[model samples]
Target: MTVDNIYDVVIVGSGAAGLTAAITAKKNGLSVVVLEKAPVFGGTTAFSGGVAWIPGNPHFQDRPDAEGGTRVDRAAVHDYMRHEAGNKYDAAFVDAYLDYGPKMLRFMERETEVEFTPSLYPDYHPEAPGGAQIGRSVTAAAYDGRRLGKEFKRLRQPLKTITFMGMMFNSSNNDLKHFFNFTRSPVSAAYVAKRLAVHIAHLARYGRGVQLTSGNALAARLAKSALDLGIEIVTEAPVAELLHQDGRVGGVVASIDGQRREIRAARGVVLAAGGFARDLARIKALYPHVREGGEHFTPVPEGNTGDGIALGERAGGHLSQGLPNSAAWMPVSKVPFPGGAIAFPHLVDRYKPGFIMVNPAGRRFVNESHSYHDVGAAMIETCRGLGRTEAWLIADHRTIRKYGIGFVKPYPMPLGPHIRNGYLRRGKTIQDLARQIGVDPETLAKEVETYNDSARRGEDRQFGRGSSAFNRYLGDANHKPNPNVAPVENGPFYALHIVMGDLGTFPGLVTDTQARVLDGDGTPIPGLYAAGNDAASIMGGAYPGAGITIGPAMTFGYVAGLSLAGRIADHRAGQAAE
Candidate 1:
């Protein structure tokens, strides 16, 4: 398709946010074009779990005959999330998001074929002062990407191999028992056998199946909507600069196949390109500790290099500070050699009772089983105290043999690297392992003795770790006294070095509630807007729940789309009246 004139709106980045904005603009009767730098459509959104945290959504309302008497009111959800975020979340932004998120979700559900279901996953801060047990996250229903035909290849898939319509392992004793029973039950066994047969038959009949799970489903839905709306998506089209006319964004200069081309936006231009997670130099400059010693692992594609922020900065956009706090850092097992190089988050639940994590000083820091966000914060603090950012995961041979520790059997997949490489350090005793890892053997031995004494007493007085329900939820079920608080007694200890890493940088071009790109003076740049990671996160420094990024990205994209269309309509009306 050839275009001679400017469209109503031009969107940069075809990820969840960008595509959502383009489709919203089209629905508002505005001409729109989406430019993506990658050969695909969905950016990080395609690689995520696709869970949107929308408190007080209609989907959470009690259904007739539902087992639980749990009722999630608007006020309750708002208060709960606010409290969960330590009341530091932007109140107005959260309010606006909660108010419009349901409507926006319904619009996608009705207008497009994007089916979704409320996830049974508990909130990350479930045991927080006012957190709820469930009904905060939503996931897209499986979609047949074949519906998009050729457009299917342009969509990104999840980085992890998540199970589709299978029971989620909650990393708790009760949950594990339930899982085992479900697999062993006669009816469940028969159902699984039938499902396997059906899958085999589908594979035989067609080269691919239509069951979209996790992030893939979400990406497929968004891609389908863009295609259905006739929104032109130019892949490998990276925006080089924002064209300005009289101090206002009027068009964009983009590089397509190494050729520079100019495209004008009659109404406005929206920037949704993701953050710079893979930019090693920028990361090191911003986070010195992480660069020097912290572990950095990201499953994001190599193309994510801060192109959106660069283009906007070139056009005089203002960036926000505190970028160091925006990343998702956690301990990860390194990938092994011979074609296996993927790093998986060292989930504490998977560690069982035989292991524990400690700092370079040979002392237990935060609860080793905490969420990555919490662990990341702890890592940062540990680094600050030690004048360096480095930690180690200590475990025993029993833990390795039982849970497969780092060397997950699926060779060439996410955890295969640990098995292939010597990253998994092993020793016959804790002291020997500590010496091998360059840590003080006496300090590590003392720390372990103190921890084992606490475990023997079935209490964690120092950290109060095993006290929380969430903590015990991820503990080993077989432990008699307590699942979470266990002694690392068995010998043949191992240690793996860990560094802090993040999914992407958070802080970027500042935008308002409407997602209009603002200047250094805190004023909106005319005909210019930003969304997704390219803009300052609306949640500030706190992560409220899953899908926090994608939720606001879609919400603000809708807002920007409407805002652009309204501007074009007003302009035409003014001209016609004159």
Candidate 2:
């Protein structure tokens, strides 16, 4: 038994969760190493919007008008959580998260290079009790990847489908609006020009854009912090098995550079490996649509294949059961490539005006402006009733040119390539588009007519499209009457094939409040912890807001690190005493 190395903590996965745990553990006077199966770090987080739904964050503490302002009411937050989690609400876990989440945010910004700015996003269901229209979600500040020096290449880049010529845009909506209106507004044009110049310069020097934004920036900042703390991030190292000895998980057996190596952990091993989104067999069993023999696509890193979950289950950790949904549902459209297609999540385009999603019958099923999860769930149920598994996002020529649909860019970007490649379907009229998309011409025409009647009046009486703050946040604020409601009476029309997908899995390894992986009987497994998508989501499989996935991930990572360092109890005692 040749032991290659030993550390106080071994974090499996290098996404936001693992890197956060590594930094926290190291800062608490423990040696930590991060093992990532992929050639690069970041996991699915690198491809995300990079926002965290962190209530009571300190960013706007002094601003009374802000959501995170002095008026932050803990009881209201608790009520919202209870409403969101419903039957799956675990009071202890939720309370721990609420107590420690803000602390973690403050610590990361103060003690490390990671920084965040308050976002203007609202709660997905602000109409719910105790929900606020703003002040909860925060986005990672854009970071210069050049600061990482030689290791910059190891940081995963944003999804190529979302980036323009390899340049990532900020997820705060400001950069996107500027680019969208560049041709019409001089101020926006100037901003776009400056941004393009910087991106071009970066490409010439770095072979990739070094001005990282969104989740890529978050990943880079965390990686830099971990590296500065002397934490070892071993990429291309896949943990094959858990090291269980004396009723405790001590370390892992990882394949590093095609060589097997045994690395031991003195305190514990934290399972922060991405999730089971790509794990075919597991997802087939857990995901409703997949189990029904429907197609599912995901844009997450392919390296996430349930490695952590399998390792934990093998070591006697319990897999949580009976969540309403198994993953953070996302509606995605396949973008045509050279040889195949890639899943592009419909994140921003759905909320824009002059567009509506329809079923095979050409009828609008769900509110297109709703959160991705709610829309996805509705999509699944709608398709199930129709005995099929697909939907179409219908848009007019004017709308498509203004907001763009799916992978197709707005005006001047040239939609010819997408149309020719069959990634986009277009027609000269409403009836022509219905035929092009395999729907009844008369039915689609009638549906469009009915929608336009209400749209012209700035109302969605059927589904209440623009009835919430969250819906309007992603919409064009300059639009008249209602930002999300506009008559689609233009000549030419287009349609995009939509399918089911996910941001990440929800139901995961069952763990206690301290992040200790629990056995089937709810007994804690010694020296074993889980965070990130590897652990069961605290939101109980519900989509609460913009950053629900990453928010709890980071908070639990902080908790797990504290537990590994034997400081969690002391901290809890201090908090209780306070």
Candidate 3:
């Protein structure tokens, strides 16, 4: 019956979407507070690649060069979305996203600590209608965690599997290139040495690296902006239920610092609490692999357990269903660490030369260099009747040492640890490797031989590995005719078992163009809005390009803030005239 505090807006979640909404609302003359269930504030965004796929981003449009300088056409972007989403495409939502996504980016960069650099990442399906080979994706610029002062400690750390000694690398290939060429190139050696020295100093001073990159940098920048605007970001606050009365959502009852308190929102409540990817029961019902008795692991924060969706449902919102896919699928392998194991999404290694993915039967099913989503979908469908949605990544000693596989790093980093931990399997010959991995020797040998035949000729007769622009983008350009094709003929082959995983869920609470949560009858639940993974993906279960999820999440979050602010402004204007 007693209320603890109140604000014009209350945002559930502190990821890119929630912080974006808070920043926008505050800038638009509304008092806002962000509540995060996790002790940390970044949600899954901090652990992500920090890239956003904005079709007409101002950064790319301002410059035209051979890399990604082509002007983005709105019509073309729309056509591409239509082709990617197929029947699930919602024109109203798509229009809103396309119209506001760029504006959102501009606003954040101009008004906050946000900054972006155009990326060379291509559309997942660059050959699709209206798809561009480049100029659509942009990643957050690297930021210094020192800017956040004390709040930097609360920022979620980057995925450990991808970092070295808690030191994160930029998503740009340039940073990795320097490390990869450190031994061969003198210039790179000095660069790596300097980077390592700086990282060591940062570790000593901050107990973690202060040079933030990727999603961590994005999260830090956003948090700094929110704090600078005098917004309250309350962590360890989990919403228990929505305060619904008079046919509208007004506030929330949340456990804050061990006390259940009522916090009313005079204007609206925005839900951006990641997604339901970790909600086992709900995923088992929605995810086909889980329903069919397969394991699913996610690298996102465990705090994202469909809290936003559940809260929306309690406030008369319904989840969107019947999408082709329920989540953004990715192939992940378990990397044995100190305690147990961690989910490591195979984002980089597969595209390198001399790597191939084979099912349990030792047959190649898909082009290993394809997008992670495509490869994951293929893996799921290939293993549908096999009871487990899984596959194995095979590589020769040369390739394994040159590029590494899964969480195992390149040469100079001993493979003994991985081999001892049973995370990696090795064999001196093809037949020997097959036996170690539980595959029939003859079948495995024949598959390798068949693949080598085409690989030697710089072609994939069966699966067209390096045929697409997107595939080649991730491939080693220094390699021969086919960057993604090479013989796996070297002895001492290595194999890692990979299974189905996801970046985030796609099926979420149904919402309108304004990001308003919708009821079963397609009516907006007043004062309740959804953004980020809490809102059904505008891409409609399809991963169109890099940063597809983050891009739209931010756009809709901006929309939700604008919607609430606009409505209040209109009401006040009418009253003032009276």
Candidate 4:
């Protein structure tokens, strides 16, 4: 098929936001095309957990009594936002997300074939205003790749940390439990039995299983729906330069197979390129501590190296800063998975009983059981003048065996491999383990004593670790009093060094609530738009829930489509009158 000379909407980056923008614009009566830089479609969203935090969704409001679906209160949400972002809160931006998010979601569901199932995962700050313990986070239902026929293999697979045997994929709680806890319960056994049977049959027929869920499912479903609608997706076409007309962005100069081609757009170009995480230069500029054992810990994909940001800025778009950090941080640990080295985000690992995080000084700084973002923020804050860049996560025998610590599998799973690889440190005594990790042995012993006492009492007085609802949700349910605390007085302890791993870039192009890119002077640059990490988060850099990132990305992408499409409609009306 020949590439079109002009499109109504030319979307840069085929991640959730770009795909969403292309889909919405196409449905809204605009000829759309998605430009993907990577050979495969779907950016980091395909590798993500795919929980979208969309409060006040119509799907949840309709179900009411559904597990993760329920009506959300607007006032409560406002309260949470105000408290989270304080005076820096973008009320109009957030209001735009809240007002249009549900409509966008409903529109996609009705018009497109994409499906979302309510996820039982709680918000990062469930105690915050309007936070729903459940309901808000919605995950994409499993997608049968077989439906895509020959296109199934073209879809990007899940990250190695997510799959088993590099062929099986799980996207939700029940699915993961069935796969990971295969021999634990009868239900799990049955689930695995069917999965194995299907795996064997599929391996024989297709060499890979087609049961896709979570982020992979979401991206695949969007791609399938877009393909079905005849939207031309040009892969391996990276946007080199945005076409400009009198200080306005009209299209993009894309690199297609090592050759540069100018792609035109009638309405505008939406910059949804992932982020600047992979760019070492940007990372050094953002976090001055980059050289100090930081990027060695970062597992972000190398593709997201600020292409969108550079294009937007060259077009006079301004970058937003000063909310939290330049990027959304997550406590990450590296481990060797099947295909390659995997950066496993440490969320559940921190909240479970018998795990504690300590700095190089061997002192517990933040509540280990808190949100991953919060923990990472604390890690950064704690290391400001402490001469330490990373923290160590100490796990006792029970924590490592019962609930795997980071990359370490449970009791039945051997840790010898991990220990041998130096991904984990083990010792019969706390002092010995401390020496292995370069922490003060005396201070380590004291920290353990203090933590063990708190665990026995079922309370964390130092940092209030297990006091929150969110903490308890991620904690071990079997534990009494506090599910987040357990005595660390067991022999054969394990320790893993944790680093501040960012999920996606937090701050990017500054845009108005309409998803129009704003200039350095705070003026909206015509024909320019941005969403997802390519745009400064509408939440002003504070994470609220599981899918908060994806929710806004898709919503604003929807908003950008509607806005630009309307502009197209208006232009046509004016031309007709003329």
Candidate 5:
């Protein structure tokens, strides 16, 4: 915690990646310290789904499904990565990750409070070669926040949008069915009542709900593991530069409590402090600012401004280029909420029934029911053509009452506020809605007519909306015919603007299979490594399913630990020889 303090491993960013590296390094008998730039621990991982899409996971070993099929195999994992990565696939990286990924998960389970379940979430590309129809993604078992005690206050909270009334929303089928069945079914009503009773009791005690899932639970588990191992986690400590010793990376100079502090690393420094989503200038250099004239916002913590990328650059680390996306992009909507304007990532709502996306030309472009990354990427390409800077999501009163559009809550909740805030536009006719949103009236009218006809037939001949398992998984489960297909045929329609939002920045420092940061000539920067968004992703430009980000993050963090131990030993041996 002081200048000149030295540790065997110094990890920047206290998210899943950084903490995993810290834990694994400690497991290897290395003294480790984690420095966080934000005011609290748990970077974006705390606000995430907390699912790790690691195939060959042991949790699925004896797990059986309602349909009686096991979920994973090593071969299937290989097929998925190969197919998803396409031309950008890295065989050695995939092989290395596959070797260590499950090992890391098992180690965490055996050694830490981090428990995982072979969750029923489907793959994003379920039909891909070797992809599991059910999925290999595992959700973090819910942790009671009170166990951290006062330290729980130091854990970053999940995004307000991901939670409901300050309580983390469980996304499992049974959990969701309870919420969706609020007024319709007695079973759902009872489930909600029981959940509310527990939540209320928790709120009275912990000040936050007791049930922690998603990223919050993931962060808490990792943080608790570090705490258990006597690892020091220093928040509000920003690494200013990667220090060098004899032309090799040694440690870091950071700013803590507004004072410059030098922390010497005896072995190596791992960069996992997230990516450059908040660094608008930096992001614009790689991606065109298509959101400038329209709606665009990121739900990631504002503290994420590419500190790791910047420090690595100063230390001669090479930033990667031409990723599938420079960030984990998603469509975001800005809507006025109780306290202020909240930028909400339109995840489940877009893929649900009764919604359509149109660019400035009032013509439908991408498949609305596709994965968020795909939809956002398509929006980027759509914007590039003919200077179209805006897009809109349209839905009918029925969809709004059932699923909620943008920030507007379901029916029974008054729609007046959203309409007043301009987050939603209401129109009695399709042509009127088009004019209200500045779209060509006739073109939008035609698009609507065609879409309505397709919905009636339970098919989208244009985009194949309900075709994939992943797509249907996100759609209305109880809907008839195709869950993703629904007619927007009623009057009093709603619309919200779309923009490029991302889970986090991508295309970070180029690294080898060992998770060591690379140089311009494709050499590892000695004493330097990266994981999570801090390093170029192993998944190339594709998002295969849930937890892809966190899965590789923890895997390579473990790899970084193992690699650092070897690198340090080799360096020591070389010194002894000298």
Candidate 6:
């Protein structure tokens, strides 16, 4: 029962990538160990909305005809991603990913007990010329961490509550329908009854149910499988340094319970310790405009502070600059959580009509309904010469009363205490509001008038506001003329200041297609690999689909595991032959 001094593979950060690597290596009969920096396993993966974009998946092809049964063309997916990334993506890495992603998913499905289902959610770039509606996203079925027995304590449950059985349980428009129904009709009663019955059945039998969302489900299932394979996950063990011999990784120096321990990796070591979002100083240094003071908006975990990147750099690894483009950006309301903050789901759906956002010069900018990336890019662009980066969401009485602006209930309340105390402004007229927010009152009034005219005509000629399907999908369906093209007609307006907030920093150690960490010369460091946010992202600068970070993390980790273990076996055989 003595603890082995060396393992075949040592994986740092027991998130999706680390766990996936451990499981794959163990399956190949290689002794593996995982070290997690946080108190629990499953880093940010558990908190994400899981939707892996797996092109050419078989399950999609096996779906019913009405559900659109057919494999996604590899070429179409590649072209779509290239166009989405604006040709900034690494062609070789992306091609390798597209070729192997489906195969990796299939391998995990066939070899392990993890189960997955296709999601009907369209690609985020569904309208990008080559984008399609169905067959693009896949999610794991809910797994009972309880199945891991003692290992359950080591796994991290989602920081938020998750819905079971692919049920319309997460933040979706369906939540609104359910709320209205619960308050107004008996149909809601019947629907609740059926949903409750299904939950009960799943709890009594499988110990878990599917979720309408995919991220949480995927993390739980991966954790369960890793535990079942006897992979040892040591929590609160942060890898501080990589042990090397002749320019190759030999082991790792890890901190466990404040005590340092050296765990040798006879075969290799993998770094998946995530990114530097929580580190305020690093963020300001790298991305100055996106400051960390004012109102709270980031949903990222506090522990994600670039431990992996630091360790890799200490070991002479190269880092990528534009990789920060992989960061997750969002427009969040000023709702305060205990240690962090979260975007109120209602605000996203509510802030459509009677509101328009403007830059410091008081001019309408990009489409208000564009994805957060485009929004963040626009914010950065608008504030290019302003000496600071900031924007304002202008809304009037109509929007306040109709959709409920803040996180507080009944919505019409003028900027809750959180917003008012932090970064929000209110006034009786557009000019007054502009003055208070430090914008040109005349320009602000003119922008509002122009927007109102467009709203009256049921069109946005400036930005094609309602043109994209993705924009309209998240728009207020109750609006007339167009769901996304509403004007600022009502007076007694309010404007809330907004800055670009990110989930985590995405720039990190550069890695090859096999997830092997590379050195300054652009050569892979033998016996060293990285995955997830800890490594240079495979998506290059674009966020193509939901769970892009976790999906590639898991995929590349699987590949790294197989490659490393095979090398170990080959080494042993060669030694025997000698």
Best by TM-score: 2
Q: What global local distance difference test value does model 4 have?
A: 0.79
Model 1 lDDT tens row, 1-578: 45334787889998778888898899988888888888888888776667777665556655422422133365755666567455345666665565557667767777886766766645666776556677766776766667888777667655542232221222223323433334345864565456556656655754444556556778788888888888888888888888887768988888776788888888889999987777777677666565565556666767788888877777778777754366655455555445665555564433355567788888988877566667778877877746567688776655554444543421113333443466777667888989888889999999988888887776666676555545655665566576666677787776777766565566778877677888888777898988888888766556655567777777777767767777222221322110
Clashes within 3 Å, all models in order: 6, 0, 0, 5, 1, 8
TM-scores for every candidate against the unseen true structure: 0.82, 0.97, 0.96, 0.92, 0.92, 0.82
What residue runs in model 4 are displaced by over 4 Å at the alpha carbon? 62-72, 167-172, 179-183, 200-204, 291-296, 337-340, 386-388, 567-578
List where candidate 5 sits over 4 angstroms from the true fold.
Answer: 1-4, 62-75, 289-295, 337-340, 386-388, 567-578
- Between 2 and 3, whose TM-score is larger? 2
User: Residue 347's C-alpha lDDT in candidate 2?
Assistant: 89
TM-score for candidate 5, please give it: 0.92
lDDT preference between candidates 1 and 5, better one:
5
Write candidate 6's Cα lDDT for 377-440 as tens digits.
Answer: 6777777755666677778766655554544322323455745465446788999999988899
Q: Which scores higher on TM-score, 1 or 3?
A: 3
Sort all candidates by TM-score, best to worst. Answer: 2, 3, 5, 4, 1, 6
Name the TM-score of candidate 4. Answer: 0.92
Against the unseen true structure, what C-alpha lDDT does each candidate score?
0.68, 0.88, 0.88, 0.79, 0.82, 0.68
Those runs of model 1 whose alpha carbons end farther than 4 Å from true positions after fitting are 1-5, 63-88, 127-130, 160-211, 291-295, 322-324, 337-341, 347-354, 385-388, 406-420, 456-459, 472-483, 567-578
- Report residue 114 deviation for candidate 4 (angstroms): 1.4
91 Cα displacement, candidate 5 (Å) = 0.4
Q: Show the lowest summed lDDT stretch of 10 residues, model 5.
A: 569-578
Model 1 steric clash total: 6
Model 3 superposed RMSD (Cα):
3.7
Summarize candidate 5's per-residue lDDT along 551-575 as a digit string, tens digits: 9999888888878777322221322
Record all residue pairs in model 6 with backbone atoms less than 3 Å apart, i.e. clashing.
50-214, 50-215, 164-210, 165-210, 166-210, 166-211, 166-212, 404-411
Count of backbone collisions within predicted model 5: 1
* CA shift of 345, model 1, Å: 2.9
